[model samples]
Target: MTQNLQYFLIPFMDWRIMLLLWGGVFAGIWVGAIPGLSGTMAVSLLISFTFSWEINDALAVMCGTFVGAVYGGAITAILLNIPGAPAAIATGMEGYPLAQKGEAGKAIGLCTTVSLFAGFVGVAALAAAAPIIARFALKFSPRDFFLLAVMGILLIGSIGGGDPIKGIMSGTVGILISMIGMDPSTGELRYTFGSLNLMAGISFVTAMIGLFGVSEALTQFRTSGAKSPKQNLTKVIPDWPTFKKYLPLAVRSSLLGVFIGALPGTGGDVAALLAYDQAKRTTRNPETPFGHGAYEGLVAPETANKGAIGGAFIPMLTLGIPGDAITAIIIGALFIHGLRPGPMLMIETPHLFWMIVSMLIIANVALFVLGLLSVRPFAKIIEIPKSIIMPIIIILSVIGTYAIQNSVVDVFYMTGFGVLGYFMRLYGYATGPMVLGLILGPMLDSNYRRTMQIAEDRLFPFVSGFFTSPLSFFLTASIVFMLFSQTKLYRKWRGIE
Candidate 1:
C-alpha cells in the first residue's frame, strides 16, 4: 500500500510532470475545439516527438490531452451546433438551442461542472473496479455489438425533432450514404459507381462537417441579418442547487459512460448518444422541451463522455485491448515505450497504473479550471453577427473536411451534404439522425455479418443465441424496453405525455 501510494504521488512530486500535464490539457482543449483535429491525431503526433522522453512523462501528457480533448469537443457543439468531435454530436442537440436562447454561458458552466464530476467517477471506477469491468466487457460478442448499434439507431426517434417518419428517412439515407465505399468484408464495390474517390467511402468526419457545420451556416443564411444571441455571463458557474438538481442524472450518465467505454469498439461517441437518449426518455419534466434547449439534455452527454475517459483506460491497462481509437494509439505508445500491455501488464507494472490514475485526476482538475475560464470567451463567439460568422463557419467546415483525408473531393462532398442538410431542415427533417446513422451504420453492418458467420448462416441458432447468453439476454431486454418506451401505450402508462 505504501509503495502504491508512493507511485501515485510520484507524478505530483515532479513539477515537470505536472507542467507537462497542464500544458497538454491546455493544448488539447484548443485542438479538440477545432473539427478534425482529433485526440488521436494529437497523441499520435506526441509519440513522434516524445519517443526520447521518459515513458511516465509521455503517458502523463497523453492522458491529460485525452481527458481535455473529450471535454473540448462540447465547446463548439454548444456554441456553433458543430461538434468538434463525434462524441459531442449529442451535446449539440440541446446545447446549440441553449446558445440560441442566450444561455450558452450557463449551459457551458453546468457542462464543465458535471464533466469534472464525471471525470472523477470514471477515474474512481478505473482505480477500484477496472479488472472486474474489463472481464465483463470481454463477455460481449459480435451479436451484442450489432444489437448495440441497433439501439443507437433507435435513438433517431429521440433526436428527431418532430416527425418520426422523417427522422427514419433521414437516418436511412445516412446509412445508404455510409455504404458508398467498398465493402470491407467482401471487397466489393458498393455505391461507388466506379469512381476512385467513391471507393474510399465518405468519411464520417466529412459528413459531420457538412451536415452540422456547413449546413448550420446555410440555414442561418435563410434568415438574413439575424443578430447573435447575447449570452448571460454574470453567473457562468452553476449554483449548488442547480448542480444538486442534476446530480442523479450526472451519476447515471457517467456510470453508463464507464460501462460503454469499457466495451471494445465503443467509445465516448456511442456512450454520449445513448445516455442522451436515456435521459430524454426518463426525465419527465424539463424546463424546456428537448431539442429546444433542455438542461437535462446537456447534462447527460457531457457527463457520459467525460466518464468515458476513465472507462477507455480500463481495457487498455487490464486486457491489452483498445477500448476506442484513442486508446488504440495509447496502446501503441505503450509498446513503443518497451512496456507490454496485456493481462500481465498490471502484475508487472503496477506503478504505471497508479501513476496514470493520478495523472488523470490532475488532468480533470486542469480541465475544470480551464473550462470555466474559457466559457465567457466561447460564449462570445456565438454573439458574433451571423453575416460574418456564417462564411467563416463554411470555410472552417471545408478545412475540417479536407483535413480528414487531404482530399478536395471530401470538401465537395461536404458542401453537397451541407446543401442537402439545409433543404432537409427546411422540410422538417432533423439532421442529427442522419449523422447518427452514418456513425453506427458500419458498426451494425460489420458486426451483423460477423455474427451470422459465427452462426453459420443458421437463422434459428442465431436468434436463439441472443436469449442463451446472459449478456445478450440483458441487451435484448434493454432493446425491448427501449422499443416499448417509444409506444403511446407505454408513454401513457408511465404518464410521460
Candidate 2:
C-alpha cells in the first residue's frame, strides 16, 4: 500500500510533470473548443513530439489534455448552439437556450463544477475498482451493445422539441443517411449512388458540423440585426448550495459515464447522450422545460462526459485495451514507448497504473481551475454581433469539414446538410434526434448482424440468447422499462404528467 501511495505521489513531486499537465489542459481547451479538432487528433499529433520524452511526461500531458478537451466541448455547445464535439450534442439542447437567455456564464459555470465532481467519481472508480469494471465492460455482448443503441433511439422523444412524429421522422432519415455507405459487415455497396465520392460514407462529425454549426449560422441570419445577448458573468462558479442541489444528478450521470466509458468502443458521446435522456426522464418540475434552459440538462451531460474521461482510462490501464478513440491513440503511444499495455501491464509495472490515476486527479483539478477562468471569455463569445459571428462560423465550418479527411466533397456535403438543417428547423423538426440517429444507427446495424450470425440465422436461438445471458437479460428488461416508461399508463402511475 505504501509503495502504491508512493507511485501515486510521484507526479505530484515532479514539477515538470505538473507544468506539462497544466499546459496540456490549456492547449486542449482551445483545441477541443474548435469544431472538428478532437482530443484524438491532438493526442495523435503529440505522439510524434512526445515519443522521445519520458513515459511519465507523455502521460501527464495526455491525461490533462484528455480531461480538458472533454470539458471544452461544452463551451461551444452552450454558447453557440454548436457542439464542439459529439459528446456535447445533448448539452446544446439546453445550453444554447440558456445562452440565448443571457445566462451563458451560469450554464458554463454549472457545467464546469459538475464536471469536476464527475471527474473525481471516475478517477475514484479507476483507482478503486479498475479490474472489476474492466471485466464487466468485457462481458457486454454485441446484443447488449445493440440494446444500448436501442436505448439511444428511444431518446428521440426526449429531444424531439415536443414533437414526437417529427422527431421520429428526422431520426429515421438520419438512420437512412447513416446507411448510405458500404455495409460494415459486408463489402457490398449500399446507398452510394454509383459515386466513388460516397464510398467512404458520411462521417457523423461532418453531419454534426453542418447540422449544428453552419445551420446555426443560417438560422441566425434571419435575426442578424438582433443584438447579441448581454451575458451576466458575475457568477462564474456555483455556490455550495447550488452545487449540492445538483449533487444527486451529478453522481448518477457520472457513474453512467464511467461504466459506458469502460465499454471498449463506446465513449463519452454515447454516455452523455444516455445521461441526458435519463435526466430528462427522471427530472420532474424542472426550473424550466427540457430542450430549453433546464439546469438539470446542463448538469447531466457535462458530468457524464467528464466521468467518461476517467472511465476511458480504466480499461486502457487494466486490460491494455483502448476505451475510446483518444485512448486508442494513447495505446499506440504506449507501444512506441516499449510498454506492453494489457493484462501483464500492472504485474510488470504497477507504478504506471498508479501514476495514471494520480495524473487524472491532478488534471481534473486543472480542468476545474481553467474552466472557471475561461467562463467569462467563453460567455463573451455569445455577445459577438451575429453579422460578423455568423460569417466566421460559416468559415470555421468549412475549415472544420475539410479538416476531417481533407476532402473537398465533404465541404459540399456539409453545405448541403446545412441547408437541410435550416429546412428542418423551419419545419419544427428538432435536429437532435437526427444526430442521435446518425450516432446510434451504425452501432445498431453492426451489432444486430453480429448477434444474428452468432445465432446461425436461427430465430429461436436468437430470441433465447437474450434471456440466457445475464447482461442481455438485464438490457432487455431495461429496454422494456424504457418502453413502458414512455406509456401514458406509466406516466399516470408515476403522476408525472
Clashes of each: 0, 1
Task: Indicate the TM-score of model 1.
Answer: 0.98
Summarize candidate 1's per-residue lDDT along 246-328 as a digit string, tens digits. 99999999999999999999999999999999999888868898889899999999999999889999999999999999899
In candidate 2, position 221 carries an lDDT of 92
lDDT per residue for candidate 2 within 1-497, as digits (tens), equals 99999999999999999999999998888878878877888898899899999999998999888888898889999999999899999998999999999999999999988988999999999999999999999999899999889988998888888579999999998998898888877889999989998888998889989999988899989988999999988877889999999999999999999999999999999999889988888886788988779999999999999988889988898899989999999999899999999999988999999999989989989999999999998888889889888899889888888988999999999999899999999989988888888888999899999999999998999999989999999999998998888898987787667
Indicate the worst ten consecutive residues by lDDT in candidate 1: 396-405
In terms of lDDT, which candidate is strongest? 1
> Which window of ten consecutive residues has the lowest lDDT sum in model 2?
488-497
Count clashing residue pairs in model 2.
Answer: 1
Model 1, backbone clash pairs (residues 3+ apart or across chains), number: 0
TM-score of each: 0.98, 0.98
Off by over 4 Å in 2: none
TM-score of 2: 0.98
lDDT for model 1: 0.92
